[model samples]
Target: MPERFPGCITRVRGISAGHFTDTRRPTGCSVVIARPGAVGGVDVRGAAPGTRETDLLAPANTVSVVHAVLLSGGSAWGLDAAGGVMRWLHGQGLGLDAGSPETPARVPIVPAAVLFDLHVGADPARQPPVCPDAAAGYAACQASLERGALAEGNVGAGAGATVGKMFGMGCAMKGGIGAASVTLDGVTVGALVAVNALGDVRDAQGRLLAGARTADGAALRDTARALLAGEPPAALLAGRNTTIGVIATDAALDKAGACRLATAGHDGLARAINPVHTCADGDTLFALATGQAPAPGPGLNVLAALAAEAVARACVNAVRAAASVQAGALWLPACAQELPVAP
Candidate 1:
């Protein structure tokens, strides 16, 4: 039997995850495959987001389900990776039926989101910036089928991710991908987040986990505190930062309920990251329901609460699992590397 990934999204029935990491550059894509199809809903809270096929996820849309979701690096350019996922699903003969004559075959429904990690391996003077593409997406799908456990941290979409950029890359710390799940009765809700935010990350108890550092680069400089103190950001890049992820559940839910779950996920983001959902951050979350378990007695309310907890834990895990990175002149440290050891 394949090894199980404890607390990962794959713990939910009908869900599987795979990733493709670029060797030449710190960039890649992550694929969440639900080949059997599942109800999908999305909520984009970030002012500037890079996404594809999100409109169909709205409650009013006609599409009933989604086969997969893509989270990738390379900003808007990464959206192309979804095409590769479509090709893989098509090869497997898995997709929604297209009733039209021009396209009679099954068409896979893939919704995607991208975060900015274009600077990790960028050498503009020597070569063009490398980004995730269709091939990367296809490779990710293949890996998903072969791997039983999902790898977290500096891999896949979050390969080049970073956090606490208020003071710029000089003080920013490495961020990556993390997954977690919450089970109540028979229902399971899981979250997978790629942390690349423009703000500081904190735990549920409000303790600073990672964020910008002082000029001396010794300790964390709370972004919210600095902002409230009327200190201006030393470096601000608009539309260059985002935190993207997906929430999955085994409970039954319609499009509207899924959307509500997606919204509830943002509460998790807020709980873990300070100064989120800003003009510069594109925080987007997608929710999927496999409908394998009965709906909770308290309806989506209970499920939403569980989702929030999972998301928060996933976000925290992302930073904690990340390892320090040295890409060119940028030497971003991971939270684990910077945090002081308990005495």
Candidate 2:
């Protein structure tokens, strides 16, 4: 994989990404594993969010090592996957060293979050919930244990993802997972994101890439504009949209720096996803450092900048990699087929 893309995320030592999906229902989960345990941090922006172990990633948190980070579907229920991950790590004897005769010497720390993908596929009443659980989480981890090229788009937590629902599902489009990596000198940064937002998706150049469309599917439409007009084609929802992801690097960094890096990582989401972090979304990002490279003398400023770029690139890649699908009253247009949205 490195021979083709020297900047591949898997090139980082002791890092692997895996995804598990139930395509029948359009819901799944993605796992990012740092077997050596990387310093981790998180930043949450959306008003309605679902998460697990985010507090541990805070600067004030006592724990310093995070064994894995899980991004999944099925709203709060998806958090169940974390337990499976913890058990897997514990079985492997990987985690914080507690060093006690009574209790296990090591306990793995696995933080997780989920996006709402229930609105897609068939009606909510008729379908069984597809949120990833202990079994699914364990399966994804076992698959991820192997280091290799990671797959993106229409997988993991993004399987049932859709965007531009400000005007409701009728105007929404399909969203998926995207990934990108960068290497410079001795620093390497990579990002993976599941693109699911309540607004349109865009490119760094500010061009409309994929989004809501007119009734006839003649052209794409601006979701914000429709909302600003003081009317919506469909009723707005409370918490069915979000964009979740992780940014990782080999540089040495503390929990605080990781927190700051995660904070800065939002710029990438803001850059690529129009009208982000709305009340209905659960936008979140996690940053981790493997400490393979020397710690920056400053606040890891250069790597932070690169982290933002990596995220932006990943966002674009997600949109580009997504395949169009029909969900309820909406029809998503793949990036490859995206024509100019109506002005």
Candidate 3:
């Protein structure tokens, strides 16, 4: 059967996403484009983070909307992808109205972040480290703009991604992109996450799905357990992971409410991924509202709860959809590859 696109995020009118992958380079990006602009806010919880245009979303900032959000690999170098997104939106005449006087103009507003995936993927001596740049970002935007057809796993920002590096790549498992959404009384909430963390992925039932493996390549081990064990080798891996995502909703909301939703989304991360929000992990979540659907009578809290659940589900979906690959000398099996994890 063909792959199914998770349509949760796209369910929100005016919101669309595109995934562009460069298989040869083995690195890419995910672009979430909002029609014109959508009310937006973000929360960065991880100690080490790489982001751009987030200041514009501050509660006191003048810009209340964002045209797009970019999540990419290549650490800070991947931030360049937002430039391409801006260029694309500009050509479509979408952006903040800054030009005055005679000529009508619009300056696109794009917020973006990055995750580090250079530790492996290709042989260092042969392929050279790969990262997404302006050209690559522009190309992804050009591929599609309409809603639906959401891509997950080994693609976009999740490409060249890995997780559970607590014991280094040898025992680390593969991580990728995932998405989920929910609808309540006409209000729709959804999430899309790039699962690259220094922890393990778990299902709602608290079952260990994927993460660090036994040294002999046997069973999966809880990342936190390995660290608590105080093994001498556990100190080898430091500050080399991140999990970034976007929370989308159709309900009307202001920047403050959006920020709250972003903050609440982290609770889902904590439940789904063990040992999150670490100094080595740049776990950030962005929330956007299109203002088309009616806000619940109880306010944004209702939507926020839905958003949290959606994020937790998306994290698991990311790992399940991931495909195993040979990253240079490192080999990351599929979430179900030769392992006893249920897919």
Give the alpha-carbon lDDT of every model: 0.88, 0.79, 0.82
Residue 58 displacement (Å), model 1: 0.8
Model 3's TM-score against the true structure: 0.93
In terms of TM-score, how similar is model 2 to the real structure? Answer: 0.91
* Cα lDDT of model 2 by residue, 1-343, tens digit: 0011224455555578888887567788888989779999999998888888899898887998888899998888889988887887788778888877777578888888789987666566664565788887887788786656677778888888887776656656778888888777767788888888887887766777777776666677787676687765565566778899998888788899998888888988888888898888889999888877553423477778888888887877777777887765646666667666776
- Given candidate 1, what's the lDDT at residue 257? 96
Ranking by lDDT: 1, 3, 2
Residue 114 of model 2 has an lDDT of: 88
Better of 1 and 2 by TM-score: 1
Write model 1 residue lDDT over 1-343, tens digit each, in one string.
1122359888888899999999988889999988498999999999999999999999999997999999999998899999999999999888999868875878999999999998776878744468899999999999998756688889999999999888777878888999999998888999999999999888767778788877667778788888888978875667688999999998888999999999999999999999899888899999999987654534689999989999999998888878889999888888876553221
**Candidate 2 colliding pairs:** none
| RMSD to truth, every model | 3.4, 3.1, 2.9
Poorest 10 consecutive residues of model 2 by lDDT? 1-10
Off by over 4 Å in 2: 1-8, 122-128, 227-233, 294-299, 327-330
Candidate 2 vs 3: which has more TM-score: 3
Candidate 2 achieves a global lDDT of: 0.79
Best by lDDT: 1
| Cα deviation of 100, candidate 3, in Å | 0.6
